[model samples]
Target: MKIRHLRNATALLTLGEHRLLIDPMLARPGSIPGFKFFGGGRRPNPLVPLPPDTFSWLEEVTGVLVTHPHPDHLDTAGIRWIREHGLPVWTSRLDAPGLGKRGLTVHSLEDGALGMGVERIPVRHGRGLLAWLLGRVSSYYLAHPDEPSVYITSDAVLTEDLLEAVERLQPDVIIAPAGSANFGVGGDILFSVDELVTLVRRAPGGVVLNHLEALDHCPTTREGLRERMKAEGLLEKVLIPADGEELHFARPERARGPAAPGPGATQERERASLASGM
Candidate 1:
């Protein structure tokens, strides 16, 4: 499998013949409003533009995997592009209907949906009312017979149940949000640096960190994160890819059996549709 990191939370995941675009935010830089609402330092979002070769990459996308309906994850430009390309969109049950209303083909991203072993793991976008207002989001674990298994933790805070899922699944690669984003209040909405350290230590295989240096709210920088990882003796285990970079993974010698969706951290699939963080 090859994962081509495009931009913030947007990547082209290749599993065998499938090239699935994950959470596309295809807007030009500064088109979206700033996300940092307090404590100053707010600027128009998408701090940087997509890579020069982004259009070439999009031509190969067979489908899209949306983790949520947030603007940063799936903005207006991304929606229009998908429609123009006539591509199928796979997402959690909670997000499928809303995405379909936006005029894109939508399908459930559950186990057995895409000719692969898929598991939908629910996660908390933040704590207390912030999480509630952020609405429901999900992480996906995909296992293909000819490719390595991967767990994509779409925006989430640290939680015991999530760690348990990691321990249980033991995916070959883990792609997590490392932006440590906050609206300048209510603590961090994504994983803190310390939490990321802990997570790296626990991961059995390589861990790819994204969601950095692309948004106004996400304070984590790739250079700073790399230095911290080096300090923590995790440089070998973690990969902080630059925009437009790609990483390849092959199935290990000890591959596991077919993946089954766990009950996951949260079971309440029904929730309000408030994609608050724009």
Candidate 2:
């Protein structure tokens, strides 16, 4: 599998024959309003533009995966691009109806939706009343039959359910947002640097961090995060790719030991927990 990190949470994820564009925020720099509501540094969003080669990579996208409808995740430019390309958008059931009303061809991402084992892992976007106001977000675990599995933890704050998903799935690659975003008053809407350290430590496979240095509200820098990870002896296990940088991972050879549970097993547990209010 290959993941090319674009600006913010947008990435070109190549798994098998599919090139899924994840959470595209395709806008010119400063085109959107600022997200930092409390702190003084309230500059317009998308502090930087897409890398020069972004259009070339975008041409390969076969589908779009939107974890939510936040403007930062899917802005006007991104929606326009998707409509022009006529690409299929795969998103959570909770978001399908609203997104469909906006005229994009939307599909709910369920188990086996894209010829892969899919699990929607819910996460908190903030704390307390702020979390409720930030709305719901879904992280996805996608496992293909002949490739390394990946878990895309969309914009979220640290949570027990997230940790549990990492521990249980042991995906080959885990992609997470590391912007450390805050509207200044609500504390943090995304993972703090400390939480990212812990999350990377808990992940058994490679961890890819994105959502850095793109928006004014995101304070974490890639260099700062790299230094922190290095101090924690976690530099080797993480990939803090620059915008437009692509990293590849091949499946590991199977061991001749007892077979582990199928990828669908964890999704079943997740669904049950959601149903029971656990």
Candidate 3:
């Protein structure tokens, strides 16, 4: 599989015959309001612009997978782009109705949607009232038959349940948000640096980190993350791509079998897990 990083939480993922855009935040610089409401450094979002030749990449997008409805994940510009292209927006069942109201072609991203094994893992966007206000967020484990399995841990803080999912799935690649985002008053809505170190150490295969150096509230920089990973001796399996950078992954050297259940278990177990996990 191939992934082309576009911006904060936005990227083009190629799995098998599909080119799916992931969590596209396509707004121009400073278009969105600042998220750091209580912080002194508050400013309009997207301090930087999308990389050149972004349209060229967009032209090939076959679909979209939106993990959540937050502005930074799927902004107005992104919605407009998807509408204009008339592409299918595959997202969690909870987000489908809201996105459909906005005139999108919504589809539930479940098992067999894209000829892949799918599991939607519920995530905590923040703590307490803030988390409740943020609503339900989902992280997905996708296992394509011909490609390496990937776990996209969209916009979440670390949890024991999440770690357990990682252990069970044993994905060949993990795409995680590394911004350590905060509103300057509450606890971080994304993983902290220490949590990231733990995550990298526990990963069974390669890791891809993003959601850095773009928005006003996301304070973790790529350089700082690299330094921390290096110190922890976890840099070897991690890839922190710059804007517009492309990455490729294959099956791991250790011959772990298919990430998902076999044919006999696919139907019942897949349905059971998705229902209970969410």
Q: Which consecutive 10 residues in model 2 have the weakest lDDT in total?
A: 265-274
Model 1 lDDT, residue 195, Cα? 94
Q: In model 3, what lDDT does residue 153 have?
A: 96
**Candidate with the greatest lDDT versus the true structure:** 1
Ranking by lDDT: 1, 3, 2
Q: What is the Å distance of residue 74 in model 2 from its true position?
A: 0.4
Q: Where does candidate 1 have its weakest 10-residue lDDT segment?
A: 263-272
Query: lDDT score, residue 31, model 2?
Result: 95
Q: Report the alpha-carbon TM-score of model 1 versus the true structure.
A: 0.92
Best by TM-score: 1
Candidate 1 segments exceeding 4 Å error: 260-278
TM-scores for every candidate against the unseen true structure: 0.92, 0.91, 0.91
RMSD of each: 8.2, 8.8, 8.5
Writing each residue's lDDT as its tens digit, candidate 1 over 1-278 gives: 78888899999999888999999999999999999999999999899998877878789999999999999999999999999999999999888888889999999998877788988899999899899999998999898876778899999998997898889887778999999999998989999999999999988788899999999999999999999999999998888888887777767655355583221111011121223210
1-278: candidate 3 lDDT, tens digit per residue: 88888899998999999999999999999999999988688999898998877877789999999999999999999999999999999999989999999999999998778888899999898788888988899999988877788899999989999999888888778899999999998889999999999998888877889999999999999999999999999888788888877776664434333355221111001111212221
Kindly report which residue pairs in candidate 1 clash with one another. none
lDDT of each model, Cα atoms only? Answer: 0.87, 0.85, 0.86
Position 28, candidate 2: lDDT: 95
